[model samples]
Each structure stands twice: as structure tokens, then as C-alpha cells.
Target: MSSRSLPTRQLATVLFTDVVDSTRQLAQSGDQVWARLLDALDAVSRSEVRRRGGELVKSTGDGALMLLPSPTAAIECATALHAAAGQLGVTLRIGAHTGEVERRGLDVAGMAVHVAARLMGSAGSGETVVSATVQALASPAAETYDDRGELSLKGVPVPVHAFAIRQASPPPVASAPLPVGDDRDAVTRLLRERRYEEAAEIAPEVDAATLAEALLAAGGRVEFLDVDITLVRMLQDVLDRLPADDAVTRSRTAAKLAFELRGDPSTAQDRRDLLDLATQLAESAGDAQAASEALLATVNSLWEPTGALDRLSAAERVITLTRRTNDVDHELEARLARLHALVEVWRIHDAGLELATYARLAARLDRPELNVFVASRRGMLAQISGRYDEQARQGEIAYTNAVAAGMPDAERLRMSHLFPIERDCGTGPDLFEAGLEMLRELTGIMPGNFYEADVAWVLLTLGRRDEARTELARALPPLLTSSGYRWLFSAVLAAETTAEVGSAEACQRLYDALLPHQDLLACVGPTFGGGVGERLGLLALRLGRTDEALERLARAVGDFDEIAALPWATRARVHLASALRSAGDIEGADSRLAEAKDTARALGMARMLAQIEAEDGGR
Candidate 1:
């Protein structure tokens, strides 16, 4: 064809597929067998592409690239190819993207093709991944897309949003009749009865408005009352089935779902994204209450210091919007969110003021749950600020209120919160043992990386280095599966534990994984502790990088003190002092050690005080 007559660019869906572990298959099975298998795979892939109106552009030995008219066609073709390859005892990793592509004779070249190839490389064996553009164009089929979030594709200039397409299930048949009584009441009864599957099945039979109301009501009823993962999943499915055009319904449901997923280590990333999406939707819908709630949820999810500025910004917006709308509940929530973010960012004075305002609002509102939440925040603040006795006192009140108010997860939260306080106070080995036991039990009830890492931290503190290492190993798998403040905290704890018991090489691996996020700050326990930089300093010390350790620890100490985290500041000082002493800087070491000792004594930290005294005695 003449260049003038040829099509330079056209919108198309590009699909890339490759055999999983082709090298292994070739090495295990000789060239003869491999060639046969490759032939069979190529035949099946081409057949699927042809059936879906996709043109095979070229083959790359173990796989082929194809072009389809639409994203739906491309996705269907990829899914079919996956199933066909599975039947052939082969696994294929596939990726698809919808964008403008340059048609060069029989072959195609463009950003879309490169993106698809990178996405294919990202997919696991037998998995199909697609770019957000493809997902948006796939229409009803897009509902099957499970968001994998943004991924840094190799060779791509920017991060690409990707989704994994799950195998489609048959549409639910409304064969079952709706339960009797009020629609909301029926759904609530089913949820309370734990008939989640049945509730989900019947939810779509109700009108869209009624289903939205029932789902929101059911969500509120079970939110703090139980750990019902199945119920939450069912509710999400029901909400997904509701009319998408109703932004209010979508925003409310998303906010409610985000709340349900918050603090759940397995769903931390999801919670963050869902809250963000909810905020956007609510704002677009002009629903101030929903937007404020979503903003609060967003603030709760952002545990990293890097996120502190964004968290504060969102909180301030929430306050402004709620005040204008006269939403007292949301206004109080905004104040609490602002207080939390302020603390994370080391703006203690601002946090203290916000905390006082929050306390007054909670009192005036006379909400028991709100009172418990405020008390918990106060206890956390006091612990960080070197007020150990006040922390203990506030903690007791918070736990009491939590129990009295019937918060189902209250005991687990309380135990986790108090363990570090006890450790700092040298309250006894018994508290650590008790904390470990509680964590073990809680893990059985709801397994998570956070609980496992907490267990590892306690074990490390108790000097059971080997046991802590094992617990850290157990925690690593889940931490690798997600990204969020909780995951970062867990990963850091695991790294610290590993450094205590594992080889320098193993410690190096963990440290490298954390390097990218070193600037992120988060609460380690009841205090604003565990900045990425602080943990890096500890890792550096373990790796025998004394000068680097001293520098990083000094920075960490300054950061902690600025945030009014006296306990953490003392800990950082102690680390710095130890590094300084090792480097023969006697005067510098003495100054840091004296500062640490004084702070520890003020905080009533017996264990740290004893350690400092022993070091001084040795000198």
C-alpha cells in the first residue's frame, strides 16, 4: 500500500500474551516437546483472537501480539486464550490496552502496544491485566475488573492504572422471593442472622433507592458490632449492583464500605482508594455529609508522615464544608481527623488545640463511642508527650468506655495500644507475654500482618530473638501483598526484628525494601513513632554504618522532639549515643546519653533508665 493511502493511526485494543515460565518449560522439556507445546499454544491463541474479531499481528516465539476492534473484544479474547491455555496444561500472562495505535503494514507500534507488553509482564501466571483505558471502554464487562491500582510499568514514562479481570460469573437469577416485612428490616434480619448470601441475592430484587438505604443501614448496624467479613463483601456486591447513575448512593455506599474496610490489614490499600473515590463522588454530588465522612476516612487511612500534609488539607476541607452545611457530627469528625493528622506531622500544638475542641464537642454531643474515641486519641497523645501516668489513666478510661459501649474490636485495639506503654515503663515481662497471647488469639480470629508484626515486636523486646525472627517471617508475606501505613509499619517492625536475629544480608534485603519509603512517618504504637528515616538509622547501625547511623538518628531525634514525642525522641537519642560512643566521640556520646536518660527518667521508663545507667557505669 502507498504511504499516502495507509492508515497512520487508529483507535484499537492491543493484546499481549506470553507463556508463563517458558524457559523453565524449555529446560525441563526438551526442544522437541517445547516446540510441540508452543505450537499448540500458538494455535489456540490465534483461534481465540480470530473468534473475537482480533487480527494476529505477530508472534514472539512463545506468544503472539494481536489487535482487536474494541476493548471488550480484546478482553474476551484474552480470557478465552487463558482458559484455552489452561486446558492445554499451559499458563499464559496476558495484558490489554485501548488506545490509538500506529498501523505499520501488518505490524503495529505505539505507546499502547508498549503499555500492553509491560502490563503483560506484570501479570502473574494465568492472570490477565488491562489498563484503565481498556477497563473504561469495556462497559458492563468492566464490572468484572478488580482494581490492582497504579503500577510502575517498565519503560513507561508514568505509572499506569491497571485492573485484573476476574472470571465472569453468571448473572444472579432473582429466582428467590424477597423476604417478608420491611425491605430494610428484612435485609437487617438476614444480616443479623448471618445469611449474607441470601441477603445479597435478594438485595437486587428491591428498588435501587430501597437497596441503597438497606445496605447503608445494615452496614451501620454491623460496623462496630462485629467482624463480619462475609457481610461486608455481600453488602459491597449489592451496592455494586445498584444503579451507577446515582452518585449519592454510590458515594454513600463507597464511604460505608471504606469504613468497614478500615483497620483491616488485608484491605488497607483498598480502604484508602475507596475513601478517595468516595470523596470525589460525594463532592461531585454536592453531598457535604458524605464528602466529610469520606474525607475523615481518607485521613484515617493516611498513616504515613508523607501523607500528613494531604491528610491535614483534607481535614481542613472537611471542617469548612461541614460547618457550612451545619453538619455537627461531621464537623466533630473533621476536628478529630485534623487532630490526628496534626500529631502525625509533628504539629503538636495545633493537635492539642484540636484535641481540646474535639473533647468539648464529644461531651456536648454526649456520644459514648465518640467519648471513647477521643479518650483513645488523648491517651496516645499523652504517651507520645512523655506523660506516662496520664496515658495509663486515659487508656483505662478508653478501654472501659469501649467495652461498655460494646465495641467488638475494642479489646484487641486496647491490648495492642497498651503493650508498648508497658514495655516503655518496664512494667514486667508479663505484660509482653500477655500482649503476645492476646495477639496470637486475635490472629486466629482475624489474621493480619499488623498483629503478627506486633507479636514479633513483643518477642524481640523480650529477648526471644529467634522466636521474633520466626514471627517476622510469618508477617512478611502479607506485608508484601499490600501497600499502606499499616503495611509500612508492619514491614518496618519485621525488618527491625530481622536485624536483631537474622544475618546482615537478610537485614540488608529488608532495609532496601524500605529505602523508597524512608521519609514516610507513622505511629509505631501509642506514639508518633517509626519514621522511615528513624528505622533506616537503626538498620544502618545494625549494618555497622556508624557515621550514617549517627546522622540519621540525630535527624530522627530532632523530628521526634519537634513533634513532642518525648518517648520516641529519647529512644532516638539513645541510639545516637550508642553510635557516638562506638565512634570514640566521648563528649558527644555523653551529651546524647544524658539527654536520653533525663527524658527516660521523666517518662518513668525504668528499662531505658537502667540501660543508660549501666552504660554510664561501664564508662
Candidate 2:
């Protein structure tokens, strides 16, 4: 079998370490002392490797071999070991490299091992050297290097480029504990000075009112916009310390905390519970505006509890409360939330009208940020409405406006608003020919592994089945098992790719993950053009769940038809027809196929039309 067919082989970082002049040390020191020293080295090596989430493969008397999850992790572990060696009164040489390694139960093999071994030989005492691949992956992780140029290595087919790590890892910062009593004054002072991280450390020591005030202050800062795990823990501690009697303050704090947890899949249930607590607190205190704000957060949650219909109800409640309290901002926020829900539920025409109202209100408010948001939603509307040119134009407007407004996520946001549209509109680079490295470079600005599924989809579409399957294997597990803001887009895209190239186990896993969300549109914020039910249907068909497949596909067809999403409707009909044919419903199959052909032709979906024509041959 080819090396490519071996499932155990995968990309990984390999590290090799050696104690300098071990032979001389053993000769000078006695055998017993040298043995004791080896024990000490082994103790330190095990601790450091496990601390950095690396595997200590084996000890080689004078040194050891290790495997790490990434080149950055390997570099970290190597540097840490270097520091520890100094404390042990010994010098060491280490080399780390990243490449394909085949696991053989307890040990790893292949070219990466040999390269790493050679790299260790070339390293000077107390130095850490790494291969070019490791340097490339680790450089972006914020480490400086000294270029060692190229060298010929023993048993290597070509010359290898190497680099020596120059920068030492910074000492971990220890946060000072807060005072024993309430430190509201200290918290307020820190927040006002924009030292939010410091303030968060002491947030739990403050009373409910002070915590609420800190929340509002921190909410306005761009630093708090991104996920900070430490900050999240600090805020959760603060909420836990607050008294339940202080309904108003607790309500606001809980609502704010829910926003902080919005995009994370691990906090999905926590976010729902927090919003519920906030809503109940506000209603009990007779604070309509606060209650409205809490419900609005729920409406805007990345993962809905009961899907779009539930959000619609929450949005309506927000609207009712906003009207009672005369809160224009909450009212507008609720309306926009409702608009997105409408689209998600396949009420496209209603969503369009809601968009018009939102645009007018945004202009009246004269908020450039809100206008940029409106432009993005307009792009979604154009996409589902089958106005490809208009979709492209609106996407550009949103992208340009976001950049001009200096949004922190301007480049990342372009991935959501314009990347998929560009692919379909033929106005962007040929993704099929662009290759994975260029794709990574294009999306490098976007932080997270979710884009891996997006790249996999392009590979699958371009007929690179092996590459697509490899990426799908890497990207599917997390998306299938976790819940997050981008869950819909990532899961649907993975499902589509998986149906084409996935193994049986992967297909089953994706089908299970997506089944619960089958009724909602496969969207990221407002971007995906239509129903995820279609992808779910395709997965069901692949898994041989015939009845479920037909049910899902037929439901998707109705949804796209309801929204006038002609392109998606055409695609779903084709798939549905294929499923029907397999189920031996010949008449039903012919009817669906003819309808799909008509719609695909009308919408100028050339690729989809070709797919319909080739349904009997193979899709």
C-alpha cells in the first residue's frame, strides 16, 4: 500500500533532545552518579513535555524523542527544557521539525524522525535548532530566529534549511490577588483607566452594583470584543459572587456576560442560562428595558435554543418591551434581530421589508457601523433573491464600509460576507487552481479552525478528493462535536464535502451532528444563501437513511421555494430527484428532475444545470 493510504500517518511536530557530552560526564562522574543524573533529566523531560501537551515518545539514555501537536508547541517545550537544563547544571542540544510521521503503536517513523535526529547533531551545546518547516509554522507564533542557512544532512535526499531559536520565552505573569473586602473604588479606578484585565482580576471582590458598572465600562472597549478565556473566568467568578437580591445589577451583569460567551461553542448552554437568569431578574424588578436587553441578547445568540422560530418569539418580546420603555436603540436592535430570524425561517419577503426599515432607522441614527451592518444584510438578501450582480455589489459596499469604519475584524468579516459570493459570481481567484497554501494566505487573517471546512469544500468541488478527504478528517470532528457561532456554516460546508469524500464513520458523525439543526438555514450570521436541511438530506442519503433523506430534501425544497432562493431550490430538487430515483419512485423522480432543470436553466446556474443533466450518469 502507498504511504498515502496509511491512516496512522499524519502531519506532526517531532522533537529530539540530547544532554551535552553525556559520555564524558559518565566517565568523569561514577556510574551511580551518572545514573542518578539521568533520572533527574528524565523527571524534568516528562514534566515539561506533558505540560506543553506533547507526548514523550521514549528516553534514549542520554536524550529523548517527543511529538508535539504543533511546531509552536514543540518550540515552547524545547525552550522550556533548555531553561530547566540550566537549573540541573547541564547543557543540552535540541532540534524540532514538522512533517508527516507514521505512528507505530509506541514509536513514530518516516523522514521527519531522521531529519529531526540530524538536526540535533548539528545543534551546538545549549542551543535549539529547527527545520525550515518548523520555522515557517512557528514564526507567525511570535518567536524570533537566527537564520543558519542551508546544510547537507546524512541520508537526506536534498539540502535542508535550518534556523536557531533566538528569543527566550517570557516569564509567566502572576496576577496579584484582590483585597479581602469589597473594592468597588479600586475596580472603578482600574476600569476608567482602561486596565480592564487588571480590573477583571478584582471584579469578584466588588458588590453587584460595581460589577454592573464595570461590565458597562468594559463592554465599550474593543479589547473585550475578542475571546479572552482568563477574562471570561474572572467575570464568571464575579457573577457567582453577586447577591440574587440585587436584581437590576445582576440582570445587567448576566446579560453582559452572555454577550462575552456568544461565539464560543463550549459556553452555549451557559449563555442560554445566563440570558434566562437576566430576563427573570429584570422582569421581577419591573425593569422593562433591562428585560428587553436580555431577551435581545438571546435573539442575537449564535446558536439558537429552539432554532429560528424561537428567536422570532424572543425578538417579538424584545420589541414589545422596547416599545413600552421608549428605548429606540433596543427597538432597532430587536428589529434587526427579527429580520435575520425571518430569513432563517425562510420568510424572505418579510425579511426584505425588515431590512428596508432597518436601513432607514440606521440612516436616521447616522451610525456608520450600523450602516455597514445594513449593507451586509442587504448582500444576503440579494444572494437569496438570485441577484448575483447585486449580491456582489452589496458585498463590496459592506467590505469597503467595514474597512473605512476601522472594524477590528474587517478582513475576517470579508470571509463571511464576500468570500463565498465571490466563488459563485466568478469574480474572484479560481479556488480550484489556487492551492491550499494560497488559500491559507488569503484567510490567514481569520483566527480559528472553522475556515478549514471552507477550504475543504473548495477542494471537493475542484475534484481533489484526496486532499478534500484529508482536510475533512481534520476539520469535521470539532465542528461536529462543538457548538459555536460559526457552527452552521462550518457544519453545512463539512457535510457537503463529507458527502462527496468522507469515510463511513465521518459521514455518520456529520449526519448526527447536523440532524438537530436541519430546519435552520445553513448561514454564518446573514451570509449562507439557504437551508442546511439540504446538506443534512444529502448526508442521510449517503448513510442509506432513505426515508429521512427524502424528508429532509423535500422540506429543503419547500423552504427555498418559500424564500425564492432559486439557486438552492434547483440544487435541492436535483438531489431530491436522485434520492427518489434510488428509492424506486420513478414518477416522483422524473417530476423533480424536470422542475430542477427548468429552475437551473432560468437562474443561469450552469454548473447545477450540468449536474441535473448528468444525474443518471453520476453527480
Candidate 3:
């Protein structure tokens, strides 16, 4: 019934994966244990296959034959599954081949399948390998993949472009978690992490009385996921037994409730009521810090827009409470950072200053960790002000110091890319190198996806399109991607670089097509001559909307002007001289071109001048 007389040809990637050492593992284990392991493995495999757009065709014995919509997805699925199942002593090898295939029976059969099987044969024991057909689909995003020239397949007609997966291995300490590590101080560390509920969980796991004694001394926040309502009620009961004047204990209780209330609506109203009571008790005790903590708990239940103003008023109450009771604690500093993040989004400058004062105060406190945090906040403020250079300089020092002191990977990579953008090349190359290295080794790390895109941008600027393309290729598969927007922006910039280097109409057409995305416009525009460059480009194309160009560029100083980009937004002009030239005003064109060059000289963009010279060369 589903048969069609005519069959169409398309490039499809076929992947084959077989559980490595599966039989050995089973033979060494009890049959029951092996059975559970196999079932779980199959479940994970099936879910991953479906998510990656791979259609399962057959599962005979130890291996499965799957048809993937794209080669990239096949590789990604293979790499991730290898990591996910490693704990169970199950590893997988994937081989992908993309080419024309026949739709027959319940599956697609063709040379692509045979080649794919062969490719799989060529992969390392636990590696994922890819063929050339998959690599050629480069129009969507530029990717970095090494070209392994023609590989001789047993029966496939020719050699295919073959590549291998590369991933960074975790350190010896992190390769696998231990059954029990040195956790005598687990409750204290949990409290320090603001994981109140987690602290409570482990508190029982350890000595609860000792944990409680330690928490009373350590003074930290708590974390509670809202999924367990019964657990929260139990935890709340425990908190109710604690002394009201114990600030850290009260803060931890409030924080746990806040996380729960923010995440779930079933107990929202009740939580709000509890928070208000907590606030009152805190206020009555002249404990504004505790009251502010309670107010944060209340804000979570009302985070939605309809009640946001109410939450904001509550947030402001923290600042007011701090001022009234004069609690100069780190909580006040964090509250300021929190409020600034909110007000900055609304473009409220006065409110931002009030928030910034707290950052300055925190910086003066001089705790290394708090200083690092405050510096990062200042960098964010600088970014918001469009002073990207300042952001990079200040943020880089803090992030670098943090990393030197063994800060997390997320913070390190953040500073790396920030430096490159601000033209602080000190750490730029190393940042990109580390980023790419991470992508290859720990592909499953959530933040690796982000670092890949950003590092790709820097690589592109370095004239390493080929290298950048490799990184993009590894990251841009549509499987569980948050990389789409960045991919789009990167793709266009790559295309623009091609256009800028040559006068090719094809390159120009690609740039012309992608000009509409506002982010892309903003990104490419500021790097060039002036604001009018885009309008002038449009005017040159003369795609029949003369009025649009005329109206848009009317704010220009003249037709042939280029001094429009600036630190001098204080003074700039646009020009329509070129448009008039196309409209038959030769004298006006000469005058405009002269003026534009003179203005560009004043603006001091070396490349911008070169572009003008190249345009003259073409004429």
C-alpha cells in the first residue's frame, strides 16, 4: 500500500553500532544481572536513536543497523552513547556512510549500507567513524573535520571521506565516581553549596546531630527540588524546630522553601503564606538579613509577570531592610547583584547605580572568592554598557585568577572568549584551543556546546575558517542543540568573510541574503566602515526600492561618506552621493566619493580604506 512506482535518490547516512565486549561482560556476570543490563542498554539506545533521527532497521544479536537523516547525528549519537553506557562496561563503536540508497522492504538498502558497515569495521574499538558523504553537507554550518583521503572499502566502488570522533577524557579522579569518598564534612560542604535539602539528605546519611552542629557553625544556604512535596513538608517540620534567632539555619530553611516554591505551583499559595510569616518573625527580631532571605523565598512563588511587580517590591524590600537594620553581610552584596541584573534588563540606569554600589562594597570586602564574583559582575555591567573592552579586561583578570585557583571550566572558558572579542589576544588562542579540545573529549558536558560556538567565532576571525568549520561541524547537528542561533550567526560571518575577500557576485549574493537578521546586522555592521554601509550596499544593488534607500540614508552627511562608525556617535554623518551617481549625477558622485574617503581616513579603519580602494580597482 505504501509502494511508489517512482523512487527518488537522496544522500542518507547509515550507521551500524554493536555493543563491544558485550558477550564477555554477560558471560562474567550472573544471567539476571546481564539481562537487566541488556534491557537498560537497549532502552537507552532506542531513545537515543529516535532522538537523533535515526530509524532502527534491525537488531540481530550484538548490533543494530540504523538509517540516520544526517551523518553528523549518527556520529553524535554514537559518541554520547559510548559515554552514557561506559559505567555498565558497555561501549559502542559507530560507523557512518552517506550516499544514495534504495527504499525497499521495511528498510533502505544500497551501497551506502555496505560502505557504512565497512566504515564501522575501520573504527577503533570504542570510537565513532564517519565517511566523506557526511562531511560534504557543509552548507548548513562550517565544521572542522580532518580529511582522510580515499579509504578503500571492500565492495563499495570508491574511497569515502572518513573521519573519527575525538573526545577529551575526564581526569583520573573524575573518570568514575567512587562508592564513598572522604565525606565526613559532607553536610558542611552541602550547606556551603546552598544545597539545603541535599545537606539534609546527607545529614541523615552521616551524623545528623553532628551535621546540625556543623551547619550551625558553617552558615550556608540550602537547595530543594520541588518534585518531592512530602519531603519538603518533612524538611519544613525540621526547620520549624530550629531556633528562630539562628540566622544561617533560618536562611537555609527559607532557601529550600524558595527553590521548592519557585519550581512547583501545587503548594505555591501555602508557601507564600509561610514566607510572609517568616518575614514577620525575622522583622520582629530586628533581623533584616533574615527578613530579606524570607522575602526571596516569597518572591519565588510570585515570579510570573502578573505578580512580578509584587515580587520586585519584595526584592527592593531586601535593600531597604539591609539599610534599615544595617546588615552589611555578603547577602546584601548578592542582593545588589540580583537587583542589578533585573533593573539592567529594563534599562533603568538609576536602579543599576544603586545595585552597583553593592558590588563596589563587596569588592572592598576583599574575600578572594567574593572579589572574583564582584569583578565578574562588573564585567557584566561593562558588557551592558557596550564597553566590551572593559568587560573583557576586568572579567579576564578575575576569571583567570579564579581558574588559576582552580575555578570551574565554565568560568575559565567564559573569560577566554571574552578576551578574544575585546581584542585581548593574550588568552584568545589558548581559549579556542582548550574549547576545541573539550568538545572532542567531553562532548556531553552541557557547557561544551556553548564553548564550541564561541571558540568557532574567534577561530573564524583568525582566518582559520577551515579549523572553525571543523568545530562547527562537530557541534551543529540538530540533535538536542542549543547551538542553532550561534550557528546561524557564525555561518553568515564565514560567508561574509568570503565576500569581503573577493568581488565574487556569488559571495555577495549570500551576504545580501543574510543581511536581514538584526543580530547578524549588528555583529557585522560595527566592524565595518559606518552605519550607512548596509544602506549603501542596498543602494548599489538597486533592487528597485530607491525610496527605501533614499529615506533610510537621508540622515547621512552626504552621498559618499564613510566616517559614520565611531567613538564619535557624538558626531557622525551619512551620505547619498553614490545613489545620486547611479541616478545620473556624475559631479555629485565625485564629490561624495572624495568626502567619503576623507571621512574614512579620519575614522582610521585600515581595512575600510582597503575596501574602498578595491571597489575602485573593480571599476
Q: Best TM-score goes to which candidate? A: 2
Tens-digit per-residue lDDT, 279-331, candidate 2: 99999999896788678667655344244675677778987888788776667
Q: Candidate 1 lDDT, tens digit per residue, 1-619?
A: 0010011233468899998988888899975566556655655665667766667765566787888867778877776777667766778999888654544322456556778888899998878899876786674553566799989876454577889887743222211221224333445435433466777776666676765654554422211222356657755775677676788778767766765554344555676677777888888888886777667666654543345676688779988998898777557756765775665556778878898887886678634455566677788778777787788787888778655543333465476557667767874798788777877765554333256876788799888988988887777655544444345666767766766776687667777767866766655323444577878888888899988988889999998887777888888888788888888999998999999998888878998898788889877
TM-score of each: 0.57, 0.60, 0.37
| Model 3: worst 10 consecutive residues (lDDT sum) | 1-10
- Sort the predicted structures by lDDT, highest score first: 2, 1, 3
Report the C-alpha lDDT of model 3 over 1-619, residue by residue, as the tens digit: 0011001122356778777776787688865565455545544555667776666654434566777666556656665567657866777777876654543212344456777788888777787677654655412222355456768867543356587656523211211221222444554444433455766665556543444444433221111112344345535655665665664555545444444444343444665666666677777777666677666554444432223344556656766776676665524533643453243123335445754675566567533344444455556445433355666676776666544432223244363335424332132355556554544433333231233544454566556877766654443332112111122333333443332232344334444533443111211101111232343344333444545444444443432122222321211222344455456666655565555566456644343345445544543
When 1 and 3 are scored with TM-score, the better candidate is: 1
TM-score, candidate number 3: 0.37
Among residues 3 or more apart in sequence or in different chains, the pairs in candidate 2 whose N, CA or C atoms overlap within 3 Å are 265-483
Ranking by TM-score: 2, 1, 3
Give the better candidate number (2 or 3) by TM-score.
2
